[model samples]
Target: MYSTDRRERTQIQQLTSFVKAWSQIDPATAPFLGTWTAWEETKSIYPSSVKGRVCIIDGFIPNENNIGFRFGQGTVSNGRIKTDSYILIHQGNYLGGVFVYNNEPGIYEYAWPKPLKNPAELMRRVPQSDRHRNHILEQFQNAGCTASRPNRR
Candidate 1:
């Protein structure tokens, strides 16, 4: 079982690679696509997506809350990705599985469009509270990716 830090570190690296190869990302084969849940009140794992839903494609996060920007851009250079969803402004390394914006936090594991290849094994390493519960499943099912998700299921 990989530690939370390790898993998130790897996930961030994948996100970085995704941004670097944005133009080549085939939505049909993208791996990190899912509904990243935002918490308005607290990052409590019960009711998901309080603030809004954002999907990280190769380089954009389709904004649902009308946060001024039409689409939150994820541009990576010098190891730092400046994004409203993905944090770590000072530290260029480790973007985290959870995203924070305007005080609200988002958990990456909340939504999975398709069942993971090794969901059991992968989820086993995660903390009980952090395991995915299909929290934002309904949203993806309703709206589809819309540039905010990885692929259309």
Candidate 2:
């Protein structure tokens, strides 16, 4: 049990490092690191099947009110990457697993389709809380990364 617990802790640390690295390298993912609202106002329309569901994907998991650009396979563990992968909770219940990471090119494609049509449109539609989000995204878009992929090794 002690060994299992130690492995779990180490895995969490590894995954956090991967997320931090990926966030810095990918502009679209950077803003979401700190801000993800529950969007309680839209809960009545469609509730999250799992309460308090927080997992790192290319983007935040979109609840009804949280509709936005989301990339990557729904489950990171589904990928074949050895350094960064998903960790299953148990047999037959993969949804609850947390993704673990240790290296480059996370399970999701770092480059995602533009979520907003244009900067002007984004400025009009973005909520005050998310203004910075659009700005950073636009900067990266204008810089020609468009997808913010790390330089090929």
RMSD to the hidden true structure, all candidates: 12.8, 17.2
List ranges where model 2 is wrong by over 4 Å. 1-57, 61-98, 101-125, 147-153
Q: Tell me the lDDT of model 1 at 52.
A: 27
Total backbone collisions for each predicted model: 1, 1
Model 1, runs deviating above 4 Å: 1-15, 23-53, 56-91, 94-135, 146-153
Per-residue lDDT of candidate 1, residues 18-82 (tens digit): 43343244422233332222222101111112112223322122244322112232333343333
lDDT of 2: 0.29
**Candidate topping lDDT:** 1
**Candidate 2, residues 5-120: lDDT per residue as tens digits?**
22245544543454455455543332222111221210000011122222222234345564343222212122211113443222210112244456533322121111222233
